[model samples]
Target: MAYLQQAPAWFLWLASLGALYVSAFLPRLLVYLTHCLRRPEDLRLRYGTWAVVTGPTSGIGRSVALELARRGLNLVLVDLDAANLHEVSGTIMSRHAVQTMAVVFDLSLVSTRKGDEALRRLRDAVKKLDVGILVNNAGIAKPGAVFLHEADVEAWVRMIRVNLWAVTEVTAAVLPGMLRRGRGAIVNMGSASSEGINSFPLHTMYSATKRYVAQFSRSLYVEYKSKGIDVQCQAPFFVSTTMASGFAAAWRSSALVPTADTYARAAVGWIGKGSPLCVPNLRHRLLGWYLAAVPGGVQDWFCLRENLRHRKMLRSARSPRASACRPHGHGIPSIE
Candidate 1:
């Protein structure tokens, strides 16, 4: 204290600036640290007994469905591939003490006239169940990154349809039931390519769609939090999955890329937390903190370089399916 009183004015100002910087991120740091110690109310009890998870056959959706089931929520698994959906349902039923229903629906068709029957089927399926949780985890991207003008127009349309339209429609179908029950948790999947950086260069359309998800989740959160609905947008850096397999091996290393199951384990903990947005994986949150601190120009520059590198890697890849992004209908089936 005496030393501080004697300290020069300049030193004190510098110290104050440093303290402010540290304080800016301290709350986030604490939340990330106490996550393990904090025990949220049982989701099944707080929300309801049944949960609906879209794109539940693979990747983050599959893992999240399993995690929710472990916590005693019955699963309604939605997807386009009937075989895969049924297989996932059986896997969940056998591995965990939870009932499972497989709903085959094409997410990419949500915005078209043909989507009406599919949405009606999904609505009908969940109407009788106590649908307490909704995970809109299904999404897609164009096959590799390309300039907007260089790509076929349909590529952009498909991404918007599945990523944005599908999420919107599925939530609409599930929300009425939650409103009637007066409680639920809605988790919309997001991508770091959209939120963590300033601009995602080559994957423009894909990132733009995800940006819509983030806004949609935030708006719903404010609108429904008082009514007992918790809306959260959870974004992550690349996870090691078939969707990202086209990236360079070094960038996709296990240390940098979490597996889908690893991410899902962390995700379930934040279902009904106070925050409207989250990067559930601890590793991801740490990286996100650093990214947030960096200047936007620097981030955009590096993001462009990394995306371009991935594009070249995908083109040169020997595999027929070398794209980091999936082809149409290649997206994991989920609610539409």
Candidate 2:
């Protein structure tokens, strides 16, 4: 009693703050445990049997399609790459014995006349099917990790179109069926650059578009929750996809970077569950928390430094004089 009464004002305030922080943290930790340990919702039963995955030819999109197929969901596989899309469709059908329909559509041109025709076709194809899951996973980051001034401005335009407009238009096309059926799940792929850190120096436009995705999903979740629709944004830090392979090699020597298949497995468990904004992988959750606690300026510094280094390596590889560096990475910028 005497010791407590004698506590200084600053000490009391600090103690109260610490207690409040823990009070909030514990419940969240419990929720995460429940989400991770619980049985995943059955897609075919809860949502419908048909899952539509954009950018389904590779990376996170491809893996998610396969996982859904494994769970006995037929798929509407969409991508700009005709050959790879067909191959993936065939693979899923053969291995999982699930049906797959591949659509070769360019998302970057979603607002154009050509995109209208493609989207109309997409709508017509899926309108009759039971599309319970929609993964808005098609995305691109062309001329990546360069300064705003140094990047090709058209590349930025294309990125915005693919990342933003495509997501919006596609959702619009699919939402009607979900509304009629009164059940569906929409998973929007996001990045930790937008969700965890306040700034992404070298990858400005990419992060901005992803930030939009996170907010878009959160808002849509709120809007559609009572309507029997699940809108979730999955913000991942880094996966072993070719998109992250170059810079991730320098970040923890890629030890922390999960493979697409590994991430996909974890991600599916989180679908239509928990907060609309979710960090799926356990490692990425830790990293996001750590990065969130760090000073914003420090985060800016580290992001800029690593991104700058990655950009330099990218340029060197492209330079005619530096022929030793490998030229292409498969599965990056799925739209282009």
The candidate that wins on TM-score is: 2
Off by over 4 Å in 1: 1-19, 246-253, 318-336
For candidate 2, write residues 1-336 as lDDT tens digits. 799789999999988877876787678778888889987677789999898999988889899999988999999988888999879988998899788888888998888999899999899988999999999998886656677998777889899999998999999899999999999999999888788887988778888999999999999999999999999999998887767654523453466789999999998888988889998898888777656657899887887888788777767666666655445553222212
Cα lDDT for residue 273, model 2?
83
For residues 1-336, could you state the per-residue lDDT of candidate 1 as single tens digits? 999999999999999977987898898788777875696569888999999998988888889999998898999998999999989988988999889988888888886666888888889999999999999999886644566788788877888888998999999999999999899999999988788978888778888999999999999999999999999999888786777764434346677688888999888987877578888888888888888878999988887788787666555553555445557545432111
lDDT of 1: 0.84
lDDT of 2 at 211: 93
Residue 163 deviation, candidate 2, in Å? 0.8
Cα lDDT, model 2, residue 41: 71
